[model samples]
Target chain A: MTRILVSEVGPRDGLQSIKQVMPLEAKKAWIAAEAAAGVQEIEVGSFVPPALLPQMADTAELVAFARTLPGLNVVALVPNAKGAARAVEAGVHGMSIPFSMSETHSIRNVRKDHPAMLAEIRAVAEIASAGGVHFAVGLSTAFGCTLEGAVSEDAVVHLAEAAAEAGAQEFSLSDTTGYADPAQVRRLIRKVRGAVGDMLTSLHLHNTRGLGLANALAGLDEGITTLDASLGGLGGCPYAPGASGNLVTEDLVLMLNAMGLDTGINLEKLLEVRTILRDALPDEPLYGFTPDAGPMLDYNERIAK
Target chain B: MTRILVSEVGPRDGLQSIKQVMPLEAKKAWIAAEAAAGVQEIEVGSFVPPALLPQMADTAELVAFARTLPGLNVVALVPNAKGAARAVEAGVHGMSIPFSMSETHSIRNVRKDHPAMLAEIRAVAEIASAGGVHFAVGLSTAFGCTLEGAVSEDAVVHLAEAAAEAGAQEFSLSDTTGYADPAQVRRLIRKVRGAVGDMLTSLHLHNTRGLGLANALAGLDEGITTLDASLGGLGGCPYAPGASGNLVTEDLVLMLNAMGLDTGINLEKLLEVRTILRDALPDEPLYGFTPDAGPMLDYNERIAK
Candidate 1:
């Protein structure tokens, strides 16, 4: 069976973009249900300051709850050494740090330039390494930047090499502004892998331009094993106007299973988990096409017989 | 330059699915605007009786008006020999006859089984050939049918062979119910091409499961030149409940352009045409991510510079 790992990031990425806070109990239930649906790994929450993002204020608590689930790799998002320290103490299996490729976006989002962010990544890697936890540096705006019109390919490859050298276990290319196309995706993934080799691990994509799944397929064609997606496409970029949230996990799983690659996810069960999310964040608009149209009859038959 | 043919089917496919009828003048303006935006082919309307689909009643008149536009291929959707005769009289550049692969869908849609549909296709081809107009047989539900659980690959290839033998100058496979996955698309296109060679001309896909553009890209990879799409994703399958309309022309063009393939379409002008569509059919929802998020700045720069 061709296996692919779908890393769920709704708790951190999804909740951070929304205004409403999902209560702690609902968050726990959501994570448990998703794991039960066969999601192997999940980014439970982000270790950001409560004042900056109250929605993710319960990250430490959520991580503690998620770790109790059997056979689940509980992950968290960290911005700096402080966040990484908190994540390591919380005993997360892995922690991801965002490193922006665009100079303008880097300053606007995290108030740090490239070199400063690289130093922060190195510090976070050191902290996570001391705790014996896995570390991944997410290359944000790796495709293109909203503020800085075009992000250079060389800049991205250079950063991947730098991050790998900084003791980062893995690097993930994120279409932070959703400007990625399939050709660009294939080109960048090949370029990064050539530079950093096995250190380039995953892709975090947004459907902002409707190329999310297409771009994901390009990554798959390049033998990418890990993908970051959210349930119901939960998060939108608050800073980038009209950008969509992460690729919908349900849709991604459906496409993978249909392609005969094993995601080990029961799509029907995964869709059922959407109700829990909807109940927790009632006003948030959920977006996905598979749940609406249901699976293809042929796909259901192939799996059944 | 890599060129792609984007065949606009919004008038026939889009208007047919909706309940509200767009006025004749508005339909003409919509076609004219799209043609001006560099869309080469326009499916101006269908030849079905006005009583069956009142929205397409002006198809003959629209085709007449569309033919006057220089370099624009004025196409019409025909159901049988009668429709083909009318289409030929209208001086259409091309006429497409839909031949449903699923028996249940064929009867429900046009009251004809495969054999009967093939006979009609023969008749229509004869009429079209006599008039010096091109004829394409659209294989509806070529992916899978909602009523007929699984459409076998063998069944699709068999029909393509028979259609080629029966005198269809072109055979366009359509995912009428939107059940196609990328792997399935690549598999089927390769199978059909192997069987019929150049007889397979285009792909008509739906974004019902949000895989429209993905499937289209798969077809493109197989060197299938033509693609059928609707402006703003205007059409839906009335029979297939919850199935989305055709692939959005604007989004498809954006993807093609981003991949460095040229469709000769002006994205900004195509968007402006959406306003006319919106004004004419105010209640209808226009779907596409490009119009919402706008094109990538890098894509704009690459195209400009």
Candidate 2:
């Protein structure tokens, strides 16, 4: 079986967008259930101020809990050096720092411009490396920005190069506003890979434009291994108007598994995990076609055969 | 711009699944508005029994109305020689006859077995050819079937060859149950094309599994030009439990336009047409991401630039 890594981001990304806050215990349960379903890694929480996002207040605790799971890599989203410090202290397996390519979104999201963000990347990389944590810089709004409009591809590639040079272990390009299409996905992945080579690690895409899986397929065709997805299609950027949410993990796994690529996920178990989310976040709407349509009859038959 | 054909099938495929019957005038207005938005072809209706599907009782009228529009290819779904005769007399540019590869789905959908369906194909093809109407065979359950599990690739290719031999001007494979994945799509298209060559003309896919557009992109990558979609993702098989509907047109055009593929659609105008459907079929739910999230800021920016 050809292996692909599916990194779950529902706890952090999905929770951050919604108004309802899940209890810390429920978060642990969700992570445990998903990890049991064969998710190798998960972004358990964000190291942001509780004042800005009360939803992520339990991120550190969640990370600690996530670490207890065998064979599971725990990750956290750190906005800057302070967040990085917290993440490193928490002893996470990986930390992702988002670097918005759009200057306006950069300021709006992290209160920093490109130069300032680059400095932060270097600072966090040093802290994470010293603490023996893997560091990745996510290029948010690399496809396009709602606030700043079109983000140039050259600028995205330049920032990827800069983040790599700043000592980051890996880089990811995000469709922060779900502006990515397959051609752009192919073009940008090829462009960035050409510029930074092995430094490009994963893709963070949204289904906001209904191209999430299409974009993921495009990434896979270009040899990308890691995919950032939120279980139940959990998160949406409250800041980005009209953005739906991240690619639903169940649907992504279904596509990958059907294509004969091994995600190592037991999809039936993954879907069962959605019940935990539903029970914890009762009012929140969960989205995915597989759940709605049920598994393909023939796919199930093939498995039985 | 590189060109691709997006054929609308809402009238025949979408309306057939809904119980609410749309008035003839509303149907006309709907088709007219889509044509004005630059849809090159519209499957106006199916020639099935009025009692079986009263929603499509106006198919012949719809086809006649569709022909009044300049540069638009009017199509109708014909289940047998009777439907084909009506389509021929109605003067449609094309007629699609579905040939199910699954034995069970073949019986359930059209009440005919493989041999019987093939014979119908020959009779319809002869009638259509004499009338100068292009005849295409749609291989339903080409991917898999709810009634019959695990449709074979070899069976699908063999059926395509049979349809062509029976005088089909073109052949199409449909994921009637939305069982297609990108890898399966690539493999099946290659296999079928190797068997039927240039006779393969279109793909009829569903978003039932949320892999609709991804599957379409896979088809495009394999050199498929014509895609069958429904405005607002209308239509679902009442018999096929849990299936969603056809691929949404606006979302499909948005991805195509962003990839620099010329769909020749004015998306703005296309979205406006949704209002007509909404008003006419107020109770029917509409689906598509581009309409919800709006166009990509960069894509619109590029259009402006």
Candidate 3:
């Protein structure tokens, strides 16, 4: 059976987009439950300053807690070498940084342009390698940007090549604005892989336009091995109100499991993990079709059956 | 550009699933607006008895109204020869009968077994041929069923062969319970096509499991051109509450339009059509991610770009 890595991103991407800060204990429980449900990797939090995103204030603590779980690969997002050092000190298994393909979005999001972002990626790579941590560069807004509109595939390929040359071990095309379609995904994956080879291994997708899973399938067709998703479709894009931001992890897992691909995750236990989120953030709306519809009849017996 | 036929089924499939009967005028206005937006085909309604589905009582009137649109191909669903006769008299461009693959679903949905349904298909095919109307057989529950889990691909292929031999002009694999995945869709489309050849041309998919668009993409990859969708995913499955039913036309068109496929739909105008449904069925909820998120930045310019 072909194995696909479902890297849970609810803790970092999902929580940062929402204003509510889940209690630290709740975050720990959420991560623990997901790990127990056979999630092999989790982006537990980001190393961003608490003042900007209080929801991610517990990153170091989460790293500490998640490391105790056997076989769980803990990941954290970093903005630059400064944050990368903190993540490494906290002993995360992997660290990733956002290098926006749209220069305008980059300036607005991280106050850096192409050159400065590459420099940061270089510096972060050095720190991560020294600490024996896996490093990945996420090309945010690689699809299309709200501020800049259509991003060219050539530009995405160029940035990915630069990041790889700058010592980044892996790269992901991030659909920050949910502007990607299946054709674009296939074309971009092939284009980026042409530029960076096997380093282009992951896709960070959004369900904003309801094409998230289809886009993921396209990536899979192009041999992408890792997929990023949130527990629920939480952490919606601030630019697009009433739109789901992250692809719901449960929905993605259901599709993967139904396809008979080895995702390692158990559907029932993964679904049960949602209750922890529900209790932690009562007012926040959770999104996913599988959770609402329940699984197909005899779902357990049908996984990769 | 590859032209794909996106057949709108909101007037029939969507309405029948919901309790509220959309005012007839609203339905006519909706169809007219969609046709004006460059939608070429629409399943106006089903020719069921008024007492059984009062919601579809005005199907003949809808067919008549829709046929008047210069470029619109008006279609209707029929249960058997009796309904097909009414549809042909109403001057429909096409009429389709549901031939369920699962015996349980066949008996429950249309009160007919395989032999009885094939006889009905034969009768309908004769009437359709006499009237010079296109006839299609929708293999309902071609995917798994609520009562019977994991439907066999061999059974579906066998049924498609029988339907074609019974004079059915075209066939569609219907995921009535939304128990379809991309792998199953790709595999079944191939298997059924091997038996029925080009007669297997359409897919009637549901979004009950949120794999609707992904499944549609798989069908497109397998050379199936015609896809059935509802405006706003209005007609939800009765068995799965809080889960969307039919593939949302707005979302599907958005994906197709983004992939540069020629769906001939002006998405801006298509999104506006949701208002008619919103007004007509005030109490019922509408489902779709595109309408809620609005279109991607510069979406109009991005169509088939």
Scored by DockQ, the top model is 2
Tens digits of per-residue lDDT for model 3, A217-286: 9999999999999998888555433435799999999999888889999999999999999998998899
Candidate 2's C-alpha runs over 4 A off are A297-305, B298-305
Candidate 1 lDDT score relative to the true structure: 0.88
Which of candidates 2 and 3 reaches a greater TM-score? 2
Question: What level of docking quality does candidate 1 show?
Answer: medium
* TM-score for all models, in order of appearance: 0.97, 0.97, 0.96
The lDDT values for all models are 0.88, 0.89, 0.89
Residues A164-278, candidate 1: write the lDDT tens digits. 8888899899998888898888888998999998788799999998889999988988888999999999996666656667899999998888888888889999999999998
* Candidate 3 off by > 4 Å: A237-244, A297-305, B236-244, B297-305
**Candidate 2 CAPRI classification by DockQ:** medium
What lDDT tens digits, residue by residue, belong to model 2 across residues A1-305?
A: 67899999999889988898999999999999999999999999999999999999888888889999999999999999999999988879999999998989988877899999999999999999899999998889888888877788888888888888898888888898888889888888998998899788799999998999999999998988999999989987777766668999999999998887889899999999999999999999899988878776435455343
How well is each residue in B1-305 modelled by candidate 3, as lDDT tens digits?
A: 89999999988889888887788999999999999888889999999888998999999899888888998999999998999999999999999998888888778767888899989999999999999999999988888877666676787888889888889999999998888999889988988989989998999999988999999999999999999999988785454334358999999999998898899899999999988998888988888888777776554454323
Per-residue lDDT value at A208 in model 1 = 90
Tens-digit lDDT track of model 1 for B1-305:
67889999999888888988899999999999999999999999889888888888888889889989989999999999999999999889999998888889999988888899989988998998899999898988888888876787888889878888888998898999888899888888888889888889799999998888778878887888999999999987787666667899999998888888889898889989999999999999999998878776646563342
Fnat values, candidates in order: 0.63, 0.82, 0.71
Report the C-alpha displacement of residue B190, candidate 1, in angstroms. 0.5
